[model samples]
Target: MFWQWLTAPWQYEFMVRAILLSVVVGLVCGALSCYMVLRGWALMGDAISHAVLPGVILAHVLNLPLALGAFVFGVGSVLTIGFVESQTRIKEDTVIGIVFTGFFALGLVLLSKVKSTIDLTHILFGNVLGISNTDIYQTVISSVVTLTILFLRQRDFLLFCFDPTHARSIGINTNLFHYLLLSLLSLTAVAGLQAVGIILVVAMLITPGATAYLLTDRFDRMLGLAMGLGAAAAIVGNYVSFYLDVATGGCIVLVQTLLFGLAVFFAPKHGILARKFWAKIDL
Candidate 1:
């Protein structure tokens, strides 16, 4: 009975597509999450994800591909933040807050005025089960490209994230890497739209890497663990959502959060309980 219950969702075609896209989203987000965590760019992820709303709205109006608009706005937001912070005395966080909120508000206003069939709820929260074939293809393409780039440039990105000053001294173009990471982040956000939507996508990009961080000190191990955890969360969450009739995206993120919670107390070296146990042994 348990096995049948677990396998029931795969009986349908839509569920299969949703699961495949969700897994791709999870893996790409998980891989990029490591770089974001190491670089202290968590807020940047939030900003880009939110800032893409206007692009989505514009795409609907223009009858263009939503992913294209999303990528444009996502990358535009990053460039805007970088420019504003560099030119003015304002800090990056403050700039991020202002820019993302402004863009998000603009999107809401446009959404209210636009006479389109775009669902705001789906845009914000995702509708994974309703994913179409086009969305699947788009997501797969974007994920493949993003993953390929990340894999090829892993060493450079790691060095840049760990220490920009050292990377610059060693002749790596820190500027190029900075924008490259942001661009990849934008692409990931676009790919994740159908699986987790804008609001929750950042969580997907954050939680896996965070959970992995607690499990290992090595960057390579962190990447592997985060990717595994993310893919697992997506699979389990989809099954839970199917049986429980909950929001698929929310379920996925909740699963990731639950894993993070477990890691907090159970991870071998960095977990709270582990540290306390080790301390007691020393004493």
Candidate 2:
């Protein structure tokens, strides 16, 4: 049944690139996403995703490298958060609210300036089904960079993630790790944006990790499960979109949602339905 992808004319170089890109992106994002979710930085992921919009729009307007611009903005957003938290009396949610809205508003203005193009939907929602050669390279580079950094400091990262105070007690530069992790998150979000857009990037960064948490007991195992689940979602979503001629990012995100729901209802030790069934047996 799946052999059609090999023979179909539509499954050319670009199609292969999209599938490969999704696999790499899903794997890397899912790994880091578990850390973000566990550390309660899920909203931070959402804020970073939205905050990069202006960078993208300005890049498109200036005809510059979109990835570079987006990366700068992503880093800028994380910096802005640190600055605001230190300087202002406002709470974190308030800061995220102000920053993301302002950035997204700036993006809207820039997009309107480039109003000549009627096909701007891709900027907001992505076009994974129509990935380009350049996009493949961008995704691969970002994924590799993320993996390299993550691998090099895997132990430090684990300590920093599980307990920053303890990490600092051990002479680990906790702030450095935190900002560096933010940089990785920014890069991943920017790379995924081309294929999945800004908002869906939040789903990608959060849902797979959550689903994996339900399926695994160990942190490393959870990351592996999350990556595997993400790959499955991406591949299945692509196939579904190809046959139904639907939105690629949306389908993939919906797949993630379904996976999470299944985990919630059926996980062995912690699931709602499973717990209830066990309670009935005990009674």
Candidate 3:
């Protein structure tokens, strides 16, 4: 009965597509999540995810690809935040807050005014089961490009995230990598829009890496663990959503959160239980 239950969702074509795309989004987001965590850019991920709203609306109005608009707005918000922070006494976080909220508000206004078939609720919360072929293509292409770049520049990115001052002293173009990471983040967020939508996409981009962080100190291991956890959560969450009739994206993120919670108490070196055990032994 358990095996049959597991196999039932796969019989539907939509389930297959949802699982595939969710896994792809999970892997890419997981990989990028490492960099974001190491670099202390969690809020940036949230910023970009929210900021892409206006671009998506514009894309629909212009009859262009939503991913393109999302990327542009995502990148644009980053650049805007950088520029504003540099020119004023404002901190980056404040600038990011202002920019993303403003863009998000603009997007809401556009959504209200635009006479189109775009479902605002779906855009915010996601509709992975209803994903179209075109969305699948866009998501796959974006994931491929984001993952390829991340893999090729893995070492450099690690150095930059770990110690930017040292990376700059060693002659790495920190500026170039700064924008590169942001761009890739934007693209990844765009790819994830179809799976988890904008509001929850930041969780997909963050939780896996965070969960892995508790499990290992090594960045490479963290990366692998995060990706594995993310993909597993995607598959399991999708199945749960199918049987329970819940929101797929929410289920996926909740699964990730559950893993993170487990790691918090059970991880070997960093977890609460481990520390407690070691402390008792010392006593």
TM value for model 1: 0.97
lDDT (Cα atoms) of all candidates against the true structure: 0.90, 0.82, 0.92
Winner by lDDT between candidate 3 and candidate 2: 3
Worst 10 residues of 3 by lDDT: 113-122
lDDT of 1 at 172: 89
Q: How well is each residue in 70-112 modelled by candidate 1, as lDDT tens digits?
A: 8899989988988999999998889999999999999999988
Measured by lDDT, the strongest candidate is 3
Score candidate 1 by lDDT: 0.90
Instruction: Return whichever of 1 and 3 wins on lDDT.
Output: 3
In terms of TM-score, which candidate is stronger, 1 or 2? 1
Which whole-number lDDT from 0 to 100 does residue 281 have in model 2?
98
Ranking by TM-score: 3, 1, 2
Error of model 1, residue 249, in angstroms:
0.7
What are the runs in model 2 whose C-alpha is more than 4 Å off?
1-10, 117-119, 280-283
